[model samples]
Target chain A: MARVEVPELPPDPTAATKVAELEVPPEIVAQTLGEYLRAWAARVRAGDSGVLPVIAGLAVITVVFQAISPHHVFLSALNLVNLLQQSAVFMVLAMAEGFVLLLGEIDLSVGYVAAVGGVIGVQLVQPATTRWPWWAAVVAALLACALIGAAQGTLITRLKLPSFVVTLAGFLIFNGVVLILLLLGPFSGYPSLLGDDTNRQVLYHLMWGTIDPLAGWIGMIVIVAGLGLALWLRDTRRRRSGLVAPPLGLTLLKIVLMAIVGLTVVAICNINRANIGTVAGVPWVIPIVLAVLGAWTVLLQRTSFGRYVYAIGGNPEAARRAGIKLASIRTWAFVICSFTAGIGGLLYASYLGGMSNNVNGGQLVLYAVAAAVIGGTSLFGGRGKVMHGALGGLVIGGIYNGMYLLGLDVQWQFIVTGLVLLSAVTIDALSRRGATTGSVAHV
Target chain B: MSDANVARAGAQPNAAAPPAGEARLQVRALGKHFGAVQALSDVDLDLPAGQVTALCGDNGAGKTVLTKCIAGIFQADQGQILWEGKPVHIRSPRDAAHLGIETVYQDLALADNLDIVQNMFLARERLRGGLLDEDAMERDAAETLASLRVTTVRSIRQPVGSLSGGQRQSVAVAKAVMWNSKLVLLDEPTAALGVVQTKMVLDLVRRLRDRGLAVMVISHNLNDVFEVADRIAVLYLGRMVIQDAASAFDRQRVVQYMTSGGTNGSG
Candidate 1:
């Protein structure tokens, strides 16, 4: 083949060298601990605050509660443990909403979906009824919730309906479903876990039981060590491959923070809390919440499915063009969301010792969304962690517990939570504006 | 009629005689219509490896339509597309990708919240044990950008939203060319870019041709077309009015063909 003789134009002299002269911002190329800190400061200034605001808010709430509560009961070991136990349901529910929220969608039906799940699990394990194994009952309940999520997801994705509207409809329908399920129960309108059957006791123990103090200490150590090792290995491997990795100091700092948190939780739980009998050990609910957090964090940060969720939330058009099955991923997100909500429902039922029609599903759903937002998860999507749910739930739980200790009414709790939710959303919006305007230096 | 014939006669020598093994893609009598509105009709285009072809046209002249047809976003209503001298069907974007054809759309189709490495390896992420292999992906993304001489980005870990307009365009182009693509179609790669950024993108276009990949650029900027294009094809309305060596036509003549569909106003 003869080469075509095309007329050659003289190369533009400036074009060949201009790009190489472009300077990369220093913070972006930070390699030391000091530089990393500076970069973090810059990011926070620009509105990518990460978890700083949430942590600071939590600290303020704790301090205020400690100062204002009568006899300073807020900081007592008994109260702290009680707070965590109460927060468990909220934390799980927030996490359930987090999955869909990260995709810029919402599942308002999760509250009642969780209640339905609890009702199913409690009814199944009733000795006079089917008397199913606790594990089997839990699985069946979660599966039922998953199916509910899938049905809602299908309507939203396949019909191209707005998630807000579809989930709102689900919320109403599931509320009725929960009511009907409870009414159909053998116990009539309420299914209590107050039976002597071993299976029933197991279901009841999920929220009310505690591990031995020694076992709690050992479990804490094992978890901390395992997580720290994983973090170290991953960062070291990346650095060895000449890729971008956090500095060693930063990594060490993170590990230390994790250890400190683990030690504090175990120590507090190890203290005697009961007024009469010996009843001090880490609550089973603590590990359950932690496990959920860990699983979700991995799904969102280390898996392709998680990546696609973020991508879809950030830019659905881009995700579609990238060949992502947007409908399928979205449907799966709803399924996961409802399934998680089912777990939360089970805990709620166990905490109350029964499933009742009086379970305010509306208030619970609102709290779930509020907790997620307050914990630093953006309602606008593409930016959240499961840890945010846990932290936010603690904040919500703290306010409720603290307000009650101060002799304040439940109305006061609602007002305070509303204020916090508004502030968090304001922060999210402001930061978004800052990011878009390039007000902060390099991100 | 006489002037149109004369212009066609002049282009015939170059258009009719692409060297045997040099033409990487050949579109013959391609036609497409959306309902009653014909978007493209009887279009012929040749994209040869080791060269850049600038497809120039006005609004509604079907420049994007032709590119999308080849990119497999839209199927042609009639005619044939020959890839490496074989008639092949392109029914979807996936099929086009499998055939080594990639397109960088006008919007860039990038998630702003994701970092450069994530956006570059969006759908085709490398995986290890069912987890995203961030290390391998980062290494490959860095290498691809380096090979393209896209040095303006601060860090591959920085979000694409943090990058300047020029850098985003560079990333988008790098992503398109990363998968060993034989043919790259860039639709208005320099649109909304500053003067310096436009120059940067044009230089990148030249580099792709130098690397022996067939590049088709849909551009309305005549200066940019002349700057980087080796072959110029002008689309008038729904038909390809002219396809010839860049040396055969000057600015005003190419404009005449673009606006009038012929050198004379008769078309």
Candidate 2:
């Protein structure tokens, strides 16, 4: 189709002539295209590269590749669950980074702090040692991460040092601590906690020991109710506040999608993974992650502290003039980021069935950052959501798992992951620039 | 909240007591030097509330320095600022805000990313239950904008960056008004505006005065000063060369005070 220009009407032209003269001017069409090109360039300059479209494109590619693959098991139930399990840890870690990124800062220490937390978490909850209750162990791990974050934050804020430098120092120091605490060598402790070589049993048993029929129903109902309550509250608030809310049909459609996905996942997991005849429901980590996501969403959006973090991210001077205690907010943001990373660490150790010094800090940190960025959190700050990390992590995990299933090597997986991260960031930059240039719709 | 609150207006010479149609912000022999360069020295200015006080000066004529001194961006090296009848020391922007003195810098300091309501409530957001009370803020913002009759804005939810030059100025003024500012110091409010927008802004300035708030406008536009100001204080080099009512100074004399240091035809 050729481009057409909407012609300007004469002050008192006849309606017929006006209609007749409505032909596209080549110059006008060229100008419109020029404007669009300029707008795209401007958007790129402004750093909003339209990451959503890029994510959508990646999803499309994934679906197409899976469809063309000879292996039918690639899209099967067990594989999907495995993919989710792989994503769980990274998703949480990405969330931790997302919080700090929203403050226009990065916590380079998160990876190692997470590694340290994993060591301590496993040690505390290791079935043989049983030094503490599982809940207490989890709490201790989280608090340890929080305190570590607070220490780093204090150094950065009070001393007014660049977070990059401070967190880099933290990364080095924490990594060392993790290695020393874990004893560095193989065979330092008891044999694998989940009884050697069976991937999901230990974590699955620990989180949801007995996932009978009743447990599955209970979990499904809880998830549906939670999603429903969230949607209802949001709509009601929007209505009360007289803001333009999504249509009722759209809202209901979203809730229905959530319910379907939740019910389907639970049903699939109940299909007897055990060859000896018993099966289980979804893992407890699913609900735990959901709960954490909800809590953080509220904290980052509903509270003054959350808004202040965004304000500080968007414009620090403006925040200061508003009398916001910058140091306190910055400190708290890091604390929350680290605390969440601790949860991620625990989940990772549980998944691995043991803590090891061989944990790849470099690769893990990149994946976490990639997950957050791909999910649509801006690296520049003040623009992201918890859901981004969760979604982005799933996408990254999918790529890794899919590549492995297709018999690709680790090198290829790394290459694909890097490409995805770059593309996502580019799109984000483009979209933001488009919005600032006033060429994008619904900025 | 400092020692400058000692010398009030009534305690100073040539300082008329606050009465109907008379408003004043009296500054004593204020001095400020940026290292060796004396930006301002023994500068005295009286800006009465309910009257448009035009602070006119050539480039580097200490007009901006003096304005900054009064607005608390810089602590005057020597002297005090008297609002109403109290001597006050302005140490920071917060201090000036507490005294109900607002300064609209040339940059406007409005965040482009934020919408009208957000920008209007920037640095002073209304909160309920420890969260930003969006509904309450929106309502107040709407009311404030409506009272000012700023109809150019198609939607308050639109980002301020999307606004025309004049609309942005309107938002900035509304922000000041929301703070319940007593004396608003406008630093070249209409500098970049078109004719129609400039008229709209001038009208808003008049409305500010009508609402009993004192306004100090700094402008190089003689047409604007003549159109809005009740008095003009022209600064040449580092000294205030002429202080006259708007009724007393013509365009020619005002320009003379602005360019050369003296007015030959008058005064």
Candidate 3:
């Protein structure tokens, strides 16, 4: 073998610098607000648009609906409140699907599984039947859903079956289960949460009840203050320790944005929305949804389990080699998905004041998937946030409310949502391609 | 070996080979085979700490099979592996890791979506109050990379997908060494790298040896083998034909052993 004498290249000037200089990029080490914004702009251009596209789409949607809505009622207090209530179910359901979606998997049975939760919760609390406390009923419902998820997850992981096929079978089976459960109920195929009993009223209020205006204001201020302080302290500590952190100005800007969003939500909910009597306060559903969002966000971002989920989704082979238990993690994801779907089901039953056989489980599942996708969650997995689900659900709710105000039929709503979902998926695929080609960077 | 051959081998003398008792890993009479085929037979190797041993072999020479056996990916049919002078059974990768043996596979086994720190601390994440201690992990990862002289990466926070090939390989090596590994098996670490990237990886390999870790590099490139290896082991058709100090053989002699399984023009 002949040896090729390769020419030696000159030493890189940066190689002799300090470790910090060599390891950190200039953008990451940016010290000022101007530098940070420029770095952010560069990232956006590289196709790491993050939630920017969704926010922009939401803004455009809000303006269009406010203009075209009959009597400009889309932004009115009554309609907006109704819209939030309607969106609660979608938001929770989308969040449920997000757990599996982050693992590059999908759950088709969430729709009916959620219905089952509502059935169990309402059935157990019936006056003539078990008469269990509302909390117990809710726990039983969530546990049942978790069991169903675990069964499905086990089949997919242990049996090495495709998740799509397993969940598809679950979808049909659970739908039947929901129907059979409703039939077996003490009520005549309809379990209503409407009753004078304290337990039943408490369950009903989960979605429909409102906090006092003054209490709502207090809660908003306290929450915003706590969150803002946490963010500020964490960033400052990291920066002081000479670690990678966002600029101080960026942290302040994020806090300001959070405050503004909180103020707007509370201010809107404080307005009177009733036709006959004064009905004013933040709906109980808003805080419930926000609590779920906050908990899930922390779970997915700050825990090793969450890191493993992303790792498995991105590359299962890599995750396996890393000593992560693929079966356990995948199973847990399904369980969480089903459990959260149960929460959504409870909200749905509460919103309608009853669990009827006429609940369109099929349509609800599709909308859940749609909401997650439109909220900027990637279908291919390893990318997304729980906050995306809430935002996307709001988009769906807005379209539904606007179409209703425009006197459009349900079919038009379906068509528009389908188109929007397609656009979102297209963006996801394109950005993924861009990332692979080195034209884009993932944050 | 003649004087001319010794001169051609390079300036390093055969004294670079450590005494046999200093071997951090010892493989004796190792034999492995499938139901109908013998992948390896009667293999003997000693990987001393603080040295790089380049395992040079042709494509069907059982280089990978031997490496896998040592990595505990495949159990040897017959053999005793002595870890620091005590025989041990390595039934799985976990067992090998427990004994401070880590393998950097050819594919690297790194998640693309994860950043450098995350990938390095994949399953072994440090947690405080049940939450990932990102600060501690980052500081440690950064220090490890710096110690390895891996200065190519822009930031430890950037995702592995955005890293160049050489940088990714460096991260993999760093991950392996960070586990206090006594022996690191690198399979074709520079196979897909260009000239510069290859040099970067080779430099990292040398640094591992300098840090008192036993490094086994499997490569077909004799140029790299001669450049970095203190010792050379040539495998041919599931048989170990030659194992000696790098200064004992020139490139032609090593290639002759690799192709013919003998230096005397005999199979």
DockQ for all models: 0.30, 0.18, 0.36
| Interface DockQ of candidate 2 | 0.18
TM-score of chain A of each: 0.91, 0.80, 0.92
Q: Name the 10 consecutive residues with the lowest summed lDDT in model 1 chain A.
A: A1-10
Candidate number with the higher DockQ (1 or 3): 3
Q: Stretches of candidate 3 above 4 Å error?
A: A1-29, A437-443, B1-15, B264-267
TM-score of each: 0.92, 0.82, 0.93
What docking tier does model 1 reach?
acceptable
Residue pairs with colliding backbones in model 1 are none
* Residue lDDT tens for model 1, A337-401: 99999999999999989899889888889889989998888888787888998898888888878
lDDT tens digits, residue span A334-365, model 3: 99999999999999989989788998888888
C-alpha RMSD for every candidate: 7.1, 8.9, 5.7
2 versus 3: better lDDT goes to? 3
Q: Which lDDT values do the candidates have, in the order given?
A: 0.84, 0.72, 0.85
Q: B172-230, model 2: which lDDT tens digit per residue?
A: 88888888888999999999887867887887787776666788899988899888887
**C-alpha displacement of A189 in model 1, angstroms?**
1.3
Ranking by DockQ: 3, 1, 2
| 1 against 2, candidate with superior DockQ | 1
What's the distance in Å from true for residue A372, model 1? 1.3
Candidate 1 residue spans exceeding 4 A from truth: A1-28, A437-443, B1-22, B264-267
Model 2, span A1-443: residue lDDT tens = 12122122112224422221222111211224355445444444444443445367557746965776567566666676677778888888999999888887888888888887877776765555544665677778889999999998888888988888898898899889887867633448422445532232444344434356578778788879887988878766865665534445556666887888788878777666665767566766777777788888888776677777776766676566655788989999989988998888877777777777777766777888889988888777767888888888888888877878878898998999999889877866765554422311121
